[model samples]
Target: MQWTKLLCNYRELQLVGTLNGGQSFRWTYNKDTDEWIGVFSKTAWKLRQKDDYLEYQVLGSLLPEFSGNNTQIKNGNAKTCEESIFKSLLEKYFRLDVNLGSYYKEWSAKDELFKSACQQFYGIRMLNQEPVENLFSFICSQNNHISRISSMVEKLCTHYGEEICHHEGITYYAFPEVEKLSEAKVADCICLMSLNHLKALPVDTHVYQIAAQNYLPHLRGKKNVTEKMYAEIGDHFRLLYGDLAGWAHTVLFCADLKKFQSTDHKKEADEGVKAKKKRRQ
Candidate 1:
C-alpha cells in the first residue's frame, strides 16, 4: 500500500482525539500499527500522523470516483485523479480549511476556563461528517455510551449500507444513504455536530452540567434540562463563544469526559515514566 502525506501539524489536527473522542463512531484505533482504520466517503482509510504531516492509505478497492471532470481519467491519469479525490474528501472531512489554532487562541482569550482546558486538550476540531450518518449515529447516542453507540452504528452499516470490502477479517461498508433508510429519524444536534453549523449548540447532559457548574448556577440541582433551559444554555454559549460556539462547546465537552481524563492522565504518566527511565539510562 502506498502512503500519501497530508500537510497538517499536531496543533491543527490530533487524529486520536478528533476521531475517537465522541465525534464519529466509525473509526477504530489499531494499537499495534498506531493507525486509525475507518470507512468514510464510501471508502476505507488507514491514517496516521508523523510530526507535522498525516500519512494515509486507502485500504480497499472501493475508491470514490472523480465526479468533477472525467477528462483526467480519460486522459490516462486515473490513479492521480483518484488520489486527488481521496485527498479532497479527507480535507473536507477534517475541515482542514479551518484554522484550528486561531480558533483555539480566540476561544482561550474569551474564556479562562476554556484557556485552561486547551492546555491539555489541544487540536480537538469538529469533523464535517456525512449528515445522514451523523443523524443516525447521534440518534443512537441518545441515553447511550460510546461503546454501545459504536456497536449500533456498526450494525446499521453492516445491515443497511453497501459492503465496500473485507480487510483483516473485518468487512467495511459505506454509510447508508437517505433513500435506503426508510425508518430513519432526525436530530437537531446533528446539524451542529456534522453539518458545519458551528454556531448551533446542542445542549445535552454534559453541556448542561458544564453550564450549571460554571456559566449558569441556576441550572444546578435541576433534575432535567427543560426546553426553556436548553434554549437558555444554547444562547449563553453563543453569547460566550460567538459564531463557533458549537466548536468551543465540543472542546469543553471532551475536556469534561471521564474517558478523556483517565486516558490522557495515563498516557501522560506513561510518557513521564519513559522520560525518567531515559534520563536515568
Candidate 2:
C-alpha cells in the first residue's frame, strides 16, 4: 500500500501517549523507525506522526474476514489492501474527530491538578476503544500491570482468537468475540484471566490512591478498595465534571496510567427532568 498521510497537531493526538495510555495492549513501538505497530482489522500496520502529520503504512495484506465490512474496496478495481482502508480504520479507532486540545483547555479551567497533568500530557486523549475489548483488558488489569495485562490479552487472543495473519514469523490473532470466548471452557477462560466487564475508569494505583485520599474518603487510607466504592467515586466524578467527566478522569487519574471514568448519569438525569415536565404538562 502507498504511504498515507493525515494532518494532525502532534500536541493534540500522539502515537506514544495513546498506545501506552492505559488502554490498548497490542501496540508496540519500533524505536528504530519511530513508529507504533499493531494489528487491527486482521492486518498489521505501522503508524507514525512527524511534524504536523500522522502517517500510515500497512505491512501485510488483510485476511479475508476483514472483507465483509470493507466491501466497497473489495468490489473496486483498486487493491483490496488500499491505504484508504487503513486511514478510515485509524481515524475511527483513534477518534481523531474529537479535539483533545480543546478538551484539555476546558479541563484546565476547572482544576489545578488537572491543569498540571494536562500540560504534562497535552496531547493525550482517552481512546474510544471497543467496549468488549476494553472490558476484557481491564479485567486482566486487576492485580496486574500494563505489560502483564498486555501479555494476558495477547494470550487470550492467541489461544482462543482466530488467526488473522502471519508476517515476520509472528502470528497475529484478532481479539476474540463473545461467541468465541463463550465457546471456551470456563476453566480455560478463568486460567486465561481474560473474562470481561467495566463501567467506571480502569482503576489503577494512581486512581486508587487518589480515590482513597481525595476522591472517596470511605476507604480512608484502607488498603482495600471495593468495587462499590469504585463506582461511587466514578459517579461523584461525573457529578463534578459533568459531560466530560470521563475525559477529565483520564487527565487527573494517572501519570503512569490513564483511564476515563464516567457514566451517563447526566443524560439519564436530563431524561428524568424532561419526563417530569411532560407529566406536569
Candidate 3:
C-alpha cells in the first residue's frame, strides 16, 4: 500500500538534518530517484518530501511469519487502520508535534551558545528514533564519524540481522537485537540507552567544547576534558534546558562539529538581536 501526508510547518524537519543528525544510519538519499530510502520492518520504504507533503511507498513488507496473517483484512479495517497507523508512525518518528519555532525562541533566549546553534540550525528537529537501535548505534559511535558509524551499523545488520526485504536489488535487514549483539560480544553497548531515558545529553567533544566555552567556564583553560565530565556537562545543560535537552543537544552538537556552520549561526543571531533592538527602539 501507499500513503501521503502534508507535513505543514515542517521547516524544522529538514531531511538533511534528520538523516545526518548522527542517529539511526539506515536512511539514504538517491538523487537519481529523488527519494529517501529507509528500512523499517525490513521493508525499504521510499519517501519523497514535496513542498508540503511526504509521499511514501511501502515496496513490500518482509518477515514472512507476519505477512500471512490476514486477520487485519478479515477485520475489514485494514486499509483505513493501516493507513492511519503509517501516518501516526511517521508523525511520532519525526516528532511532528514539536513546535520548533517555540523551542528556538526559548532556547535562544536561554544562552548564547544555544542561541547560536538554534539560529544556525533553526529547522533541525531531533528524530525520535527506535530506542534499542539508537542505544547500540551510539555504542558503535564512539570516536567514529557518521559515515563510519553508518558502515558499522550496516555490517552489523547484514551479518546478524534477520532479512527483511529486497527492492531494486537492495536488501534491507533489521537491526540485530540486544541478545544477538550480546552473543557476539558487542553487548557492551546494549546495556546503556542513557542518551534519552535518563535525560542525559549526547555530549560528544563538540558539545563538550561548546559547553565549556559558553556554560561550563571552569573547563575553558583545561587541555583535556575527561569522560566523567561528559555526564556532568550533560547534567548542567539539562538543568538549564529540561527534558528535551537531548534534542537540543543534537542540534547544538551538529553546530559544534561544523556540520552546521558558525557563520550561519552568527548571522541568525545578529539578525535576531537587530530585530529585538528594533522592537525596543
Candidate 4:
C-alpha cells in the first residue's frame, strides 16, 4: 500500500486552532508503510494505494479506489488531477463562487481587523471544505479541546467500524456513518462525547453564537434550545452549500480576526451611544 500525503500542504489545515485545530490531525506519508497515516490523539487512520490510486476513510478505516466497499476515484500518477479534485470539490461543496468578491469587500469594509488578519494569516484567500464531516467534526468539537476531540473521533471510528484493508501493513476507518451516530447511545458516546461542554474554539459554538446573536435573536432568551437548534444551523449551511458545510465551519472557525472586528463594533456602538447622551445633555 502506498500512502499519499494528505492535508499538510493545505494552508487551511495548517493554521492551528483553526477548524478546531486540524493540526491535531498529524498527517504523514509513511514510505516504510507505503501508506498515509493520519494519527489523531486516540485513534489512527491509514490511506493505502490500490491498483492505481490511494484512498482512506475515518469511521470505517482505510480503503482504496479499487476496494469494492468504497466508490471513489483513485488518483496516483495524476498528482495535479488529485489536488485539483480536492480543491474543486472543496469549492463546490461550499458554494464559494457565490458573490464571494462582494462578500470579501463587505467584510473588508466592516471588519478591517479581519481583512488585515486574513492577509497576514492566510495571504488574503478563502479556503473552503466539505459539509458532512465538517458538521460532525464541529459537533465533536463542542466543549472539547483539540487533542481530546481528535482522540474521541478516532475512538468512535475504531469502536464501531470496518477496516479498509489495502496493502499488507496499512489500514484505516472511514468517518462514522450517520446511521452509527443516529443509533449511538449517550452512554456509548459519553466515553467520547463532549456535547455542550462549550469550548472557546468549537466551530459549532462559534457559529451557534454568531447566528444566535445575529440571526435568531429570540433564541437568546429562550430556555429550551434543543439539539434541534444546533442541527438546524448545521442544516442551514448544508442546504445552502451542498458540499461546503465543512468549509463554512472552517471559515467561521478560523475567522479569529473577526473576533477583533466584533470587539471593535461593540466599542463603536458604545461610543456612539455615549456621544448621543452627551449631545442630549
Query: For candidate 4, what is the lDDT?
Result: 0.42
- The stretch of ten residues in a row with the least summed lDDT in candidate 3 is 185-194
- Candidates in descending lDDT order: 1, 3, 2, 4
The deviation in Å at residue 154 for candidate 4 is: 0.7
Candidate 1 residue-wise lDDT, 87-171, digit = tens: 8889999989999999899989989999988876788888998888898898899899999999999998999898776677888
**Model 4, stretches more than 4 Å misplaced?**
1-65, 68-102, 123-136, 165-170, 183-252, 255-281
Q: For model 4, how many clashes?
A: 26
RMSD of 1: 4.5
Counting only residues 3 or more apart in sequence or on different chains, how many pairs clash (N, Cα, C under 3 Å) in candidate 2?
0
lDDT of 2 by residue, 195-269 (tens): 221123444456767767765676676666577766677677667666657566765644434332224423533
Question: What are the runs in model 2 whose C-alpha is more than 4 Å off?
Answer: 61-81, 183-205, 214-219, 256-281
Span of 10 residues, lowest total lDDT, candidate 4: 191-200
Among all windows of ten consecutive residues in candidate 2, which has the lowest summed lDDT?
188-197
Between prediction 3 and prediction 4, which has the larger lDDT? Answer: 3
Candidate 4 per-residue lDDT, tens place, 1-281, comes to 23343432222222222322342333455546544555331224445433223344322213242344332322223345544544344333223345444444444455444355444233122223223333455557567766677777667666665554343354555556566774323221121122211111222445566657654665575444467886666565455434424333334445543533467544743554476457558
Candidate 3 lDDT by residue in tens digits, 1-281: 44456464435565655676665688987866657888654555668765456776655444453377434422333465565665676776677787778877787788777786565466676666555676667777888888899899899989988776667788878877778875222231232122234254655566768888877888876666677787688788788777767677767766666544557645744564576457557
lDDT of each: 0.81, 0.62, 0.65, 0.42
Best by lDDT: 1
Kindly give the number of clashing pairs for every candidate.
0, 0, 1, 26
